[model samples]
Target: MLDHLRHLLAQDPKLAKVGLTGGLDIWLFRNSLKILEWAGSARDSYNSGNTGLIQRQAVRILDYLDGTQYVQTENIPSDIQPILVDPKIARVALLEVSQSEEPPGYLKHIGNHLREIISSPNVNDSQKKLANEINLAINNVQSWYLGVHDDAAQLIHMSPQQLHQPGTMMTLNHMFKLANNAFVGETDPATNQVKEGVSQIHYEAQRLATFDIMACSNNETSRPCV
Candidate 1:
């Protein structure tokens, strides 16, 4: 599933841009990281085979996150807070662990059995705090998953007429700017071509503006705005 998603994104730059703008790409990428972390611990035959592919995809997502200024660290969910706080550690765990003959025991020690570490008699205050933060972070990932899905569903169900409302259009225009910035230098693997991200955004903005005008016109009832 991850491989197919990556291939689809590579083949279609427009679809990739849309996914980024819609927040689906980042959501899936973050989930992939979480799944990779789980699979790393399990190390069973089924999960082990796809570890390399998931790692590569995670790396690509990390690169995109690093390059794009639009996705702020704060925008990422708390569960994946380590990615924002200590990106190097996250990168090493994702990219290097699979290459090792044995499981990366050091990485495993960080979050695995966090509850046990927090409750152990020998643990210090700092260690307990770290364990609590890890636990919170994991919980945050689950929160983000539910929240984003609800938001996406709301947008999906919106009527075209409702979407063309002034406030919604303004919000969309702002989102377009952010998406344009993120996709600025991205290359489409299918055509091996770079897209004019800003230009496309400008065009969309103009179209929206035109829609706003048409919707506000005297013949509003005669012609459908959407």
Candidate 2:
């Protein structure tokens, strides 16, 4: 899915200038690239029968999640907050985890067993203690996720109309500019192509303006306004 979206974004330079599609492309590229990398690494490991690398990939994702679970939204821009807590994004995150080739209610079943371990009379104090700790850890992960799906899933999946909100547009435009500056000298083929496309757009606009001025000078109509 990420690959397909990226392909579409790359296929059209004009989309990069439009806030709706461009903002999504920028957000996904900036944030979700690592997730895609981890999934790819896992696939390669599974293919080569190197289980160690696949285990490492899981560890990397958990570590990253642990680090970002307590993200400070206080410093985030007000306009960007709405996008963070959007319910649609949260649903997408849950859907991705739930449909991971596991049986229905897999995670829910795990949670239920944890509860039974903590409450059953046969369980010893140490066993219950471990269950309590695990339960707390899971709760911490859930709280950390909330409406902030990006912290975990790292994808911003929403409708174009949703992204076209005034505040959202403003925030995305700001993010796009920061990203544009950060990749100013990146040597990747795709990055270079994007830069070239932007340059071409600017050049064409200037050339058209110059032509308009020359035409105005040769015409008897109103003069070119500066």
Candidate 3:
């Protein structure tokens, strides 16, 4: 069922636009994962004669589907600085399946094709420049997609003291803002506020700098700040 829904959304942007507004896609994707994970638990409860457990789960599902679900955002480090984002992009970012299981390769395939074109010795200067620009754009989008998960994963392994440090907290907030821009298909202000079409290579660079600072602060000789 989850796979079918993902297929439909991937095939039809119009359908996704209508269905995924206001972070409904996030709630739906997460709840679908929960329901799948708990299916066995539900079955066991049914076999144990605790029918109320199934009934309660059904009620919760109904409530969530009807938009009564309350997500507590206070503790989520990545959500510390909330901003508007396109629902469709948000859904893509939170996709749980492996890359091979994704619907189809779009940006990556195009990027590879562009790289070949750019690298060909026969290509004209103008054509090579155009291809380079397109490749740069594709790379930024790919970076945005990867950075969200990578930053969140890093935060997950950090100690509470590390997470709450002044520099780390600032970096988290910056990352959150960058994510909002990525999700909404907006340019990063830090890189492109005055410039028209600068490449967005900010998030990963910021993340590395923050990690280096944190590591140095902890006196970890292995990864001293450069």
Candidate 4:
């Protein structure tokens, strides 16, 4: 079921990028491993009326799908796909599956990983299957994520903090903003008005210089602060 969804995303250009939004999206996306792990764990306990390991997992999947509307790759449930057309709705949907304090920020990392996996030169058919599964999982989260929140047409109103990501210019910009705070430049005597936002920007830039993405994220030791 999950694999089918992954293939759907891999085939569809429009729905593929939904995984980069939030934490819950990642957990449910990564639910691939858990769903499998739990099944394996339950196998030995099924004789005690546990409905068998597969049944237990199926029940769990049903609950998630029934309440959250997450479907497998093979079954492209109509309603959920349409809702996911809007990015914000998708983001909110992902946020729904995530814990408030989820670490590793799964969706963000998985999206990053997926991007690379799709482009790798040595990839084979099996790897592609896994890649697609991950993609579908991402879309499943997006499907639910987009169902009950901001749609694509709305104005985006997010803080800079939430918008943070990698890239040289972005790093430099944050650093500049962190180091510069009090709006520099000369003030006019007659008008008694301020003349600059440079100081404020500079203050932010300085602070950003010490901002270690590794220390901040903890899980990402490779991320540099500069």
Candidate 5:
């Protein structure tokens, strides 16, 4: 199966060189990459005198991305490949690279939740230790992410990605389902019932970690106690 995966990338040399790390490898080929590609293309459309035109182009890109979060208009992956390769567009694109910086207390909530998960006896011992580490990493990442966000807010102002990161979108979709299940029950009110779909995703996601710590836990069970 792993060899088959490698062969799939071998088909496209450009894609083959994307060099995705760990789980990120899966998101490299998704549709959101096209948005980044479009942003790079927009650089060509940038006009210092015509900010409105540039904004329109940005909006056009946003229109394509129906469910983006925060909108990362800064420091996108290099492989995303910005389009609209103009200096003005490039400048705008810089600020508008990624999401609108993660929300305040966002990581705190994540840490608290991770602590709970790790503390749960049901999660098992080794898993508990790993969860503790997960909480620590979350603590560090949230701090740095917020700091970058502050810098972006103060000194950086570029065009934001008009679409949701593919990974984020997928995670949101999953949370939406979980939220639908957890809260208000799944009742349809004509148009699938106007539920807090977006909120639900955030709510559920807060409980889950980015990395699936349980992925290989089965090995611990299957292998004999050494």
Candidate 6:
């Protein structure tokens, strides 16, 4: 599923330049950490056995996360470097996820890191702004999810008479239609906000397209699309 999604994004001219966004990004980061934690536990459980393969895989993932630096100094595209280099943004995202009622250890670790960064005197305004944006984006998506779930629960718990009522059915239909629109990149009438995943992809595509046109007008080469 991950590979397929990556391929789809890569093939699109606009989406090709986009990086991770919303729940998908958090999900991948969380799972990557979980993988390392699980591998360590397995190695500990089987001390006598050869765990070199699992250890090596974990090391590679860690290197990808921490070793490779994406910053202003590197060959990374200027448009995307801010996102790639801003550790505070990633930390804020993880912290947001950690705020769940029952967050896991990995999330807690992320929260701690975010706290440290927030408390540090060296942090800059750009980092703080990036963190704020990430948090707001996450909160928007969470609100949409909660609203949709509540509407779904109403359908699940409705009595037979309530289900049969014309008004009840209409309300349910309206709620579902709103959800469908949000799912496919439309603005939610109730909240007046676009769904995060859909909006992120759409915005990136539009931004990239505009950049390409501007580049062409200037007679400069645009970034290659997959």
The per-model lDDT (C-alpha) reads 0.33, 0.33, 0.38, 0.33, 0.34, 0.35
**What is candidate 5's lDDT per residue for 1-226, written digit by digit as tens?**
2222232222323222433222211221232233344333333333233333433444334322211332344333343333323222122211122344222122343344456666554555554665455444444333333332342222112333422223323322333333223222344567775332222323333333333433444448754344
lDDT of 3 by residue, 142-198 (tens): 465345334444443455455445554444444444344343346446887421111
Best candidate per TM-score, number?
A: 6
Give TM per candidate.
Answer: 0.25, 0.26, 0.31, 0.23, 0.28, 0.32
Model 4 worst lDDT run, 10 consecutive residues: 148-157
CA lDDT for candidate 6: 0.35
TM-score, model 2 to reference = 0.26
Q: In the order shown, what is each candidate's alpha-carbon RMSD? A: 25.9, 26.8, 21.3, 24.3, 17.5, 19.8
lDDT of 4 at 53: 33
By lDDT, the better pick of 3 and 5 is: 3
Best by lDDT: 3
Evaluated at residue 216, the lDDT of candidate 1 is 45
In model 1, pairs of residues that clash are 79-137
Residue 189 Cα positional deviation in candidate 4, in Å, after optimal superposition: 74
Clashes of each: 1, 0, 0, 37, 34, 0
The sequence of per-residue lDDT tens digits that candidate 6 reaches over residues 1-226 is 2232232223322222233343333342443343334334423423333333323332332222222332122222232222322343222222222234222222233233334444555545554444334334444434543454344334334444554555544544444443333334456699997654324433332222121132233444453432
* Candidate 6 accuracy as TM-score: 0.32
Name the candidate, 1 or 6, with the larger TM-score value. Answer: 6
Question: In angstroms, how far off is 105's CA in candidate 6?
Answer: 12
**lDDT of prediction 5:** 0.34
Instruction: Rank the models by TM-score, top first.
Output: 6, 3, 5, 2, 1, 4
Model 1 weakest 10-residue run by lDDT:
204-213
lDDT, residue 194, candidate 6: 62
Once fitted onto the true fold, the runs of candidate 2 whose alpha carbons sit more than 4 angstroms away are 1-107, 147-226
